[model samples]
Target: MTKSAEIETIAADWLRRREEPEWSSADQVALDQWLKLSTAHQAAYWRLEHGWRIADRIGALGPEISRPFSLAASLQTRWKRSRTAAVAAVVFALVAGSALWFHQRSDDVVATASFVTPVGGRGSIPLADGSRIELNTDTRLHTSVSKSERKVWLDQGEAYFDVAHRADEPFVVYAGTQTITVLGTKFSVRRDGDMVQVAVLEGRVRIDKDEGIERPRPAIVSRGDIALSRGEATLVTAHALGRVEDGLAWRDGRLVFDRMTIADAAAEFNRYSRIHIVIVDPVVADIRIGGSFQASNVDAFVRLLEDAYGLDVRREDSSIIISAG
Candidate 1:
């Protein structure tokens, strides 16, 4: 097995042990030490843990079979058979009756190009293969293109991709712990810390965790589909195509929030500027905010918050603080 496969196997074993009643401090210590040994180790553990949580969700959906032969229990059983094999089986069984789409291995990749956009900066690049990529503010990414495959690693921030069509060579994107594969499509991938969100604008894409385990049933995301994966779980939510287009307004230097929380809106606004927005009160943070604003215009947003919400705004050295009236 490859080194990645070995690490995934170890991670799966650790996850299995975690479910046992006899799990103890020593096991936890060992797992922690192992995870600290390498970023790859941590990633493997996160992927397996994510699959476990997905199994729990599947169980909750069907409480009848969940009683004795729960999806979670079945996954634990099959996991011991073989690390890579179990993932495919578990996902296939969980999403029964759905079409199975397996992950395809691509040729080896060597990072040949790198790009970064400064904070509050946006840029676009055309690749050798005719694909175009739009970098959002504060983004970093690397690309590797071979005759057989096209691959990009998103280190941070967000990017919108208009991929060139090549049936013989699939385009793959690696962001955090998620792997997104597509033939030819328009999609956006955002990586914020451990959270990864993928939105498809055109064509179809398959998304799964890149744990070195073969996933035969990845989430098939087509147009208007949004998939989010964080920590130990993943959720796929859908939106109208028009709404999806509106969400990408950031590419055009605007942020359009529709009744989003003030806290969340502040976080979004902060991504495009050095001046941060801080909510001084939890109640104020939860206030609903809506409308469109320029990405770089924090002052305008703050003014609206003060005037419309009847809140107090305080300007500090580096942050605009909002509080309850």
Candidate 2:
């Protein structure tokens, strides 16, 4: 995490702690010492505290937002009276940036690009800097590349990044609450809210938790490393390099399942198509299957499930419900 982000996080934590029921004298002493360490620390904490106070009135702003949206009008109307202009900007970022992104913010960005893939859709972005990013099904990514710094944000879904080697201009990717720094390497980041998985196919990448923004620990899989993270713990075992290649089969529009559970397979297939798959029977879900199938071909997969395994298959609108008869 950047120094600015770290300070913001620490300030938030201090604010939260002081408000707790068991907050002690020692905690206040520590906080005082921390604030005394730097003026930047004091500035961030105070601004965040003021914003925290303003946040309570956020719900009241709803009635006013019903008007046809005007970016200037909204920011002016809401923050015109606020003492700290910085907190207003922060509030607009965290609380209202989505609306801004969709409406006006995209045009304001310099040397930046935003891309998205619809449901069952796929896309690719080739940056001016020779770095390439492939967006998986239903993914959203934003990038800003300049001579001095290279940064990208994975707002949603999964993506494969083939970063061009530039030691001076490090490639930084932010996904969920994790920050990945790579000088040059091939890696893929998959995000589902707070859970993120980073798999490196070549070179190395440093993964750090951006505690100010989020707190989920990500599982890292280096070349020849197999990892399965559960809760706060992760299990990593060495595996053949070829096995890692199998996971990237999605890039070729194929879903490769190696003894994967029926439920898990269903979830994987669902990512590529709008047609949902629901495994109704727990017994049937536990059954494992393996294959390399076209991601968009759900019918073929269900046929195998029914004819090969003799499992019950029935359709319910958009869902393909499976059960053990």
Candidate 3:
């Protein structure tokens, strides 16, 4: 193997050893020397370091080991002690910046540029960057992975991303006209008709207008917050962390509704199924319903609407029309 390839390989090995609680002092010293040999060595080591951090968050390397090792009992104690100096030198190469990266790249060359999931269809896509995207029905997304950034544009529907961290590059997802930017964070974004909603399951995300402005951005969504943009402004509602996942859990064929009006509730149900719901009675349409329902059974949901509120249902083509009894 070439020198750079050998360095990358050794760095990967050091990461494996670091994850284990039992690391001999000799191994530590060798790792220190490997890290200091050249700039490429340091860069490779830091790449492994960031991988460890992101892996820990996703529980990739197994359980956390808080056990401490003492340098006083080893042959390479002096070498391991000197390795602390390399930390500062490696920061630039290892750390991912917060700036957003955008590019006008085509998604061609791979099968097709984009694909749409029909109603009741769900599938997982493995991106070139090792990140995985779970796409829900009636969804369309265009993906382009580049050396500087990873971006996916969601034209419509919902998708959950378990993003892989790339320290040298930033990952950006464009849903509707808004851009959701992150270095490495787990989140879901959905575009419903004219509305766009973003829920962060882990880490953090930046939501901003398509056209950049020099002014301070409106909001940075962290865990437990739902950012919904209608037209002019984005509304952030603090919700239970569990509900945030449940809201995006439609990828698992589950639908969750919490104190939502019939009109809003019907809209959600319509997205996943072929049978759409139309509310004819304004009064009944405004009534709030709260509960969890399976997305597969549209007939059962129609039955629930009839059972809960005394409403008459009319089936027309592909939609169910509801009116006051």
Candidate 4:
């Protein structure tokens, strides 16, 4: 078996052992030590354990959501379906609510929703499990929250997630090539067409790409990692804690830029406002700019461009056209 597979096997074994009546606190300590040995161990355990929770919570939220399934007097519940995801196998157990073992290919889901934030506006969604999603401007998002799994699709734009940890249930976000598995992490995902960016602020998240999707530059991201995914390419890099905070300045109504190109800044601002900062000249577009600006104050940004940077700025309708003075 491959290294990853071996780790998963060990994780499954640990999960099974913990259900034993004889399992003690020392065993739990040992399991914790093993998980800390590698990020792979954590990911493996999270996925496998996520599977075991499915039988208890197959349906979506409603009055029946709290109701649990009774497998049988003797046998355990089996998986509902299989998916073509890259997973080799996911172990599940319920021998007697904590005993039998089997493998499942995917999550059992019932609830689904789709929502969006208007251009230049923000919105928040609270799930039944106490997890919350904050959407950025012009964002389209779809969600499925089954009893055992929470999945989100960022069809376009950006969103911030403050997840409540349910170790048994996995919280996953899909954006471009990113198949992000969250263990109660606070992070933001942004999708601009074919490119996707994930900036993590708290806790760690696993980013795995789908097999049939575009090939990615594989990366093992840790806490505070910035993961960017595009067609046939992905880049993962770590940042200081503060840089991660700055990346989330939008939550506080601020835009922080450090030596960002004029064109790039314009695109970032365009996401938060209807006013367009149009720069057609290569010279003006290539000039690097920096500083913190209010996300909604495009007029202040325009005045800065014209007065401070000595650039010619003309307003025509909704477009603020910039050129070299």
Candidate 5:
């Protein structure tokens, strides 16, 4: 690496350590001395330090990206895995999320989300390749299109993708610890605190973890299947195709509830809306919720709760309180 590159990389490592909140006073003193060694060192250090801080801020607010289509979609029309320039392009597309977010904003808001698609504000983007992306509310994706491959890094929340086939490039979406690759596929990706849920509505896709420590075990999912990945990239479980379709029903603005808990249903609702739902009684949380409700109509859901089970819905400061009558 060049001298500047070396300095920047070193500073980045140290900054990462500093973020741990466990750095000793001696470590802090050492960092101060390193910063004072020369003007070049200080400048480079500040640049990287600022970069790390911005990344942390954005991470705290959730991923500052809109989940785009899978990389596999753009690379090949037929979805035959070719580990060539396509992988490089996919990696580049992965970074495109952060790149678009950075380039579009003034340096002042470099790490902050200037605007977020609020809950219930559904938007769609049509790519040059005829792929369509339906972004849910509170979803943030840095939008940019390029020749190599279409890429969008899903920073947070959920988005449904219907990718247009591109033989030379793959349409890929990266979220948290998981990466979803697809070609001419329809799917929904939900990125929660530490888990990523992927359901394929059409076509075949590969779900892999973002780890090189050990090559990930691949989970090949066809249409009508769901894959849940937790902890690491290791597959936890793959459910039946019908179950996958039920969980991914939100793409069509409908939610399919099959013996799910009220608490779990509320959690799912929270994903598409900013409004919070709190089940005051733990017992109420366990109550079975079935049938479909308009994903955006939380009020109707509240009314449904009242009518179906004689429960009460009271609004309290941005939170819907659910209590038994």
Candidate 6:
């Protein structure tokens, strides 16, 4: 076999070894040593690892398909025959299964692109520089990249950003009148009409007023910090990173509430479904709730409310009414 093919075979073998139930420290050390030998070795291993992750996501089909021709088994068999062909086949399968993912990545690379997600839709986008943006429900955004900087305008709604680190060309996000600047960070920006919220999950970000006659002093927000802005005034507050992450559970198709009011919770649920949750009684609206729920499973949430809190639930054609029992 050619030298490149030999390398791929070795990488594929390493990947298979990782799946073994008895993987140990010695194996990890050996793999690390092999990866240190050359950049090509690292690249090949990463490619195989990425494909393996994709396969794992596909999981099992039926009994027949699962037993005889599972993705893992097919990959191993193909590797023995031809490593190049195996990689190509796995990549093709992943591309076919995740067309939307590839399309979003392509959109980010295109110069000056616009993206919109419907009321109940969520999506992830990858930028040309390897950064990723996760759009929440009912989001609208525009992106433009230049030699000097990367820019995004959050027209409305929310998005979580995993920025690519580039010291020379900083990444900036514009939400309403606030502008968030970062070098390399994981952050989220949410715009609710006149109010804008910025939360940093990792690294640091700077919040400033957009260019104008008199710009307010910029606020330096670091990890676990949240910035809230309305008009020209901005407030920066420190928060637990875990709590911040919980607030961003929408990225994983969940909504997490911590002692939040029923009225506020219903407003959040409304963002992810066509059937609106309405509180018929003022006392019911003030009821506090805390839990993690699937974003799109409004029925499950309503059932929880009815069963746990003994609330009366009335389902309408386009709305769900909740009242005191």
lDDT of each: 0.72, 0.67, 0.65, 0.68, 0.63, 0.73
lDDT of 6 by residue, 143-194 (tens): 6553444778899999999988886778889998888999999999999997
Q: Across residues 179-273, which tens digit of lDDT does each residue of candidate 1 receive?
A: 89988999999999999988889998888878775555678888998888885467888766766787799888899888899999999989988
TM-scores of all models? Answer: 0.64, 0.62, 0.62, 0.65, 0.61, 0.67
Candidate 4 CA-lDDT value: 0.68
Candidate 3 Cα deviation (angstroms), residue 70 = 44
* Order by lDDT, highest first: 6, 1, 4, 2, 3, 5
Model 2 lDDT-worst window of ten: 65-74
Model 3 spans > 4 angstroms off? 1-112, 211-215, 230-232
| Global Cα RMSD, each model | 18.5, 20.2, 16.2, 17.1, 17.9, 13.8
Ranking by TM-score: 6, 4, 1, 2, 3, 5
Error of 3 at 63 (Å): 34
Best by TM-score: 6
Per-residue lDDT value at 185 in model 1: 95
Evaluate residue 33 in candidate 1 and report its C-alpha lDDT on the 0 to 100 scale: 95
TM-score of 5: 0.61
**Model 2 spans with C-alpha error above 4 angstroms:** 1-109, 211-221, 226-240
lDDT of 3 by residue, 1-325 (tens): 2365457556766765664568888888987887777888888888757744543342222221111011101111122332221222122112211111122336321111354667876655544344667778778776654334466789988888888777867778887668888888888998987689899888888887776533256568988888998655888877558779778868668888888999988988887788899998899989999888988788898899898887899899999999998
**Candidate 2 per-residue C-alpha lDDT over 1-325 given as tens digits, one digit per residue, 9 for 90 to 100:** 3376568767767876776668899999999999999998999888778766654454254433222112222222233232222233343333223222223233232234466676766555434345667778888777654335677899989888898887676788887667778888887888877777777788777676655644455545566664443334445655545656777888888888889999999999998888999999999999989989998899999999999889999998999999986
- Model 1 lowest lDDT segment of ten: 95-104
Query: What lDDT would candidate 2 get against the real structure?
Result: 0.67
